[model samples]
Structure formats: C-alpha cells, structure tokens
Target: MTQRSTADRAVGGLGPWLPIVLGMLTIFGPISVDIYLPSLPALRDDLAVTPALAQLTLTACLVGLALGQLLVGPLSDRFGRRRPLLVGLGVYVVAAVLCSVSISIEMLIVARVVQGVAGATGMVIAQASGRDRLDGPRLTRYYANIAVVVGSAALVGPLLGGQLAAFMDWRGIFLVLAGIGTAIWLACLTGFSESLPHDRRRAGESSILHDMRSLARDRAFVTPVLVIGLLNGAVIGYVSGASFLLQGAYGLTPQQYSYVIAAGAVTFVLGGIVAGQVGARRSPRALLPVGIGLAIAGATATLVIGVLDVGLAALIAAILAVTSGTALTVPSATTIALARRPDIAGSAAAVVGVTRYALGAAAAPLVGLGGGLSAVPLAIVMLVCTLGALGAWLAIPRAGEGASGD
Candidate 1:
C-alpha cells in the first residue's frame, strides 16, 4: 500500500483515537505557553529583572514559535510530518530540562526560546497532518476540535502551573513540562504515523528563502493567511498583556489570577465550539468581522471604563465579550485560509502561523509602552490591535467575492 493510503487507514480507520492524538499534539503549544504564565511573577523576583524584562520570556517563546514554524513547515513538506515532529519534541525535552536547571534569567530565556522553537513543531505538523486528509468545513471542524483541546489546556495549564509554583517553586513547573514532553514524544513514536507521503512530497523545492518569496506572491493564499495571523495575533496580544493586566494592575493574587484567566479561556473554548457549529452557515469573511467587532467593542469599552476607573466586575464583563468574539472568529478564518491548495497546507498554515506568533511577540513590547501594568495602556493597546485586525480582515477579498473559483 502507498504511504498516504497507509496513513489514511491508520488515521481515518480509527475514529476517536485520531482526533484525540491530534488534540494532544495540538495542546502542546498551549501547554508550553500557558504553563509558564503562572511562574512569571516568581521568576521576576528570582531573576531580579524588571517586570517588562520578565515579560520578554513570553515574547521569546512566541518568537521561537514563529521562527520554528518557518523552518518546520517546509521540512515537513520535504521529509513528511512524523520525523520532524519527533525531532522537535525531542529538542523540547532537552530545553525544558535546561529551563529547570537554569541559574540565571538569561539562561532561562534562551532555554524557553529553544523550547518554543521545538514545541512549535508539534503545531505545524499536526496542522499538516490534518490538512492531508480534511478540507473546507470538515477541516474547520477538526481545527475547532483541536481548539477545544488546546483551549482546555490553556485553562488548566496555568492553574496547574500556579498551584505548582505556589507550592514547589517555578523550577518545578519546567520539570513537569519536561515530563510532559517525554510522554508526548513517546506517543509520537507509538500512536502517530506519517501523513505526508514521499510521492506527494514537493520535489526540487526552492531554497527556504525562495519559498518565502513564493508564499508572499500568492494573493489568494496570502489573504486568508493574513486573516488568520492577525486574529491569532490579537489573541497573542491579550495573552502577552493579560498577566500584567490582571495581577499587577488589578492586584489579584496568582491563584485568583488563574481563575480570572480561566474565565477568559472558557470564553475561548465557547468561541471554538460556536465556530464549529456556525462556520459552514456563515461566510468566513462575515465571521471575521464578528471577532473584530467583539475585540473593538470590548477594548473600546474597557478603555473608557478604565479611564473612568471602573470596578473589577465591569472590566471582567467587557473582557469576556472580546474573548467570546475571538472564539467565534478564529476557526472560521482558519477554515477559509486553508480551503485552497490542500497540498501545501503545512506551508500555508505555517505562513499564517508565523505571522500570528510574530505579531503576538511584538504585541508584548507594544502594549508595554504606556505602562506595563496600568489599565489605560493595556486598553489602548488592545483597542489598536483589535481595530487593526478588523481593517486587515476587511481588506481581504473572500473566495466568492471577486475570485472566479475557489
């Protein structure tokens, strides 16, 4: 049997196990991101860095995620998905262990960069594998399913990390992550099989430099890619600023902060579920605005409320609206982005992936400009980001809008 057929049988033959495996793999990045959030405050004290500098740790991870996908996407196209994933997860294991042992903040940052780079492989590969089999709304549903898993991780990882850090110290968080990496690595070896076959592999490929050029030139490809990136970038912005916004500005305790964060995350999960249900019924172009609208309204309201010195209850309600809106928007954009060119889904997804995280990484510093923890600064930053995302999405033409065919 052909490798593609074998993979199809392996993946398509099993019903629940396939998505479960994909879900686990998808959650790896979220775990890497959220698991460390609760530890940021403790690390600030231990590393003796300013709060802004401490925030760079998260930025570093995001940068790593962006760059790693840039490398892994093409490699997966050439070598198949499974091999690079194994290598990436293996690297993550080492980085996680190194993070645990680091004596200085610089070392920890470097280790996190490595971990982010390696951890992103799972994300890119899981996407490529999903694209190899599914398309259109079906693929959107798959992404929604993965989001639920990843979203749940976002909810749980921080709480777990917070409790762990509270009791055991921040180093323990990294150690636990290392253990999770080991388990995921083993799962890759046993349960997961290659989806991209050699016969289908892109032959005589351009240099990585040239592939980037080609990606930039494809407008149909680039539009949806940009849409996904910008939307995801907005989420990353929220993540980058969330800790400071809650703990530093609002004066919530770490444990309390996790619960607050959990509330936002639950909205994210709800958004994904809603997207899966409605993505087919609504045009992606139409849905993109919903998220942008929510973000704009939420951020703008928060800005006004913060200016007026609103209390916690009001602030939470506004933020939840934005979160809920983002949840609805992301999956639909992703489904549209990957609709065409089933063959290069890895590279396609990677393009959007890189843009999202890269923007997210930048969002950290941008939001820090006014004041790291203050209310007005964060509200303004989120307002601009959400508005920007809305403009970007509106600029792009959809499949049926002007284009003759899909």
Candidate 2:
C-alpha cells in the first residue's frame, strides 16, 4: 500500500466538503456587514441618534474585523483552526443577541464590534485552511470557489435584509442574524475537521512578528497582497458610495439600487468562475495583468460616465464591469500570497486581511469627501484604486524572473 502524505490524508478527511465549509466560514464577515444595511435608517430613528452616529455602528464592526484578524492570525497558527473558529462563532451568536437587545446607540455599537471580531476568525482561518490541504491548481480552484460562495452571500444578504425589514423592526434583523450564526455554528461543529495537524504546525513554529517581517521582505508575496488589497479597497469604495450616486444624485429608489447591487454580485461570481479555470493553467504572475486590464478599462469607463453625466444604464454597466474585474483577481492574487508560505499560512493570510480591511475602511470614507452628491467621488476612487493595483502588478518580476510563489 502507498503511504499517503499528511496533506492527502487531511484532504481525505475533509472530503468534498472543504470548500463549502470554508466558504460558509468566510461568509460571516461580509454577511454581518451587509445584512444590517437596510435597517440603518430605522436603527437611527429608534435610538434617536444622528445618522452619523448610527453609521458608527458600521464603523465599529469594520474596525473589529480588522483588529480581530490581526489578533487571531498567530493564534490560529499556534492553536489550529477548529478551536479558534468554534470559539469565535459562539461569541458571534452572543454578540448578535447583544445587538438585538441594546437600548442605545452606544450599546449597539459595542455589540457590533464584538460581532465583527468574532466573525473575523471565520474569514482568516478559511483562507489558511485552504493552504493546509492543497496547493497549485487545486488550491487556486478552492479559493475561487470560496469567492463564488461569498459573492452569492453578498447577493442574498441585502435581499434577505430587505424582506426582513418589511416584516419586522430593526432589532429583529439581529435576531435573524443570531439564528443564522447558530445554524452555521452547529454545522461546523458536526462537519468541520482540523486540517492543520499538530505535527505539521509544530514544524513551522516561529514568532508571529518574525514570520510577518519575513513575508514583508518577499517581493513575490508583497505583489499580490498589494494587488488584491487595492482592488478590494476600490470595490468597497464603490459599494459605500453607490447608494449616494444612484439615489441621492440619480434619483433611483432603494429597491432599484438593490437591483444594481444584485447585478454586480452576479457578474462578480462569473468573473471568479472564469478566473479560477484560467488560473489552473497560468501562474499567478501571468494572470495578474488580465485582471488588472479589465479593472483599468472599467475604471476609465466609470470616469467617463461620471464626467459626462452618462445615464443610469451606462453607469451601471461600467460599475458592473469593475466589480467583475476585481473578482477575477481574488483567486490568483490569494494563491500567490499564501501558496509558498505554508509554514506561516495563518500569518500570511492575516497580512492580506490587515491590508484589505485597512484600505477598505479608508476607501469608504473617501466616498463622502465629495459630499456624496456626484458619481465623481466614486469614480475617482475606483480609478485611483485600479491604478494602484496596476502599479503593484508592474512591480512583480516578469515570467522569466524568479519568484517561486508565482
């Protein structure tokens, strides 16, 4: 009998459920943010807070997400995926309950922070778990499949939130979130197995800071980190401001705005599917430009649409193109970041998360800098971010040049 390697055995244990489990784990972060959006206005009125104050609830969650990943990365590397993931999910359910019962804006904000921190464990570990089981093309496909699952969650979150809002008050949304969290927690408890065995984990042991410094010095790693990081920032900036552009400026209703979001989500899923298949054959370095070019084209078109006051159809088309293009790079860039850093997979994943959340937070504020009245702010943000991603790609070594992470 042939002796199976540890990775092969681990994959066998997880079976066909690895991508689905990891995808569901990752969904909490985005779903936590998006599910409460439709309830924002009501949440503000119920607590008698300013719109800005109510929005702080969102800002709190985002900060928790960033910090939580930073804090959890090393722990996951040390303690393994299952423990941290389970604890976090448990806390998330509790946090959801807290938010539902909060009597003041301050209370809600605090609860959201707890919720975000708890939800973040799911995201980082999901990425690292993929690294634990596979490499090369299979790893690429795994990440892409996660992207498809995440995009679908984004599409469903707002739709579900909207329907819930119509039937119940703002607080009920949190209860519903709590229920979803409970179900996922139970599923993970029964179905999820530890992918990172202790022996493999011990072999790579090192200080978190040391591992981070090592990763930072690697040009191969930094390239994709910056690429995906900036692209995510741009896409999030578009999302933060799209409501303003469509409703405040162009006079579309909230329901109509949601339709555009759904369309973008669909395109995003398509891009992920296509990119995963293509990336199975091409190296990450080779595939980066294709993604970047699409992003640039969409950004430029968006800029034109904003400057010339193009009608809603053209604007939506351009924005959707940007969404799809950004999605195209998710698997390619991530494979580049985590593939060669198997020993430090958790920290490597965390570095990407830190950049992603930090830039994402920065980009959201930029949409309001132009007073939320024109598409110009959103367009500028998209163009600048895509240009940043383009520059990052250019910094990487050419095909003939050496970079094993590829």
Global lDDT scores for all candidate models: 0.76, 0.84
Q: Model 1: residues >4 Å from true position, as ranges?
A: 1-14, 40-57, 103-107, 243-251, 280-286, 372-374, 400-406
**Over the stretch 1-406, how does candidate 2's per-residue lDDT look in tens digits?**
1212566685464576556778888888778988888899999999999999998998899888888888777788888888998999999999999999999988999999999999888889999888887777777877888788889999998888888899999889999989988988998897788878776563444777777788888887888899988999988998888888788888999888889889989987888898788878876555678778888898899889888998889988888878888888878889978875787788888889989887877888898788777788888888899999999888876556776432
User: Which residue ranges in model 2 land beyond 4 Å of their true spot?
Assistant: 1-5, 10-13, 202-205, 398-406
Q: Tens digits of per-residue lDDT for model 1 on 7-107?
A: 57655532556666677778777788787776788889988889988878877887788788888888887788888989999999999999889888899
TM-score of 1: 0.86
Q: Give, for candidate 2, the lowest lDDT window spanning 10 residues.
A: 1-10
| TM-scores for all predictions | 0.86, 0.93
Global Cα lDDT for candidate 2 = 0.84
Clashing pairs in 2: none
Number of clashing pairs, model 1? Answer: 1
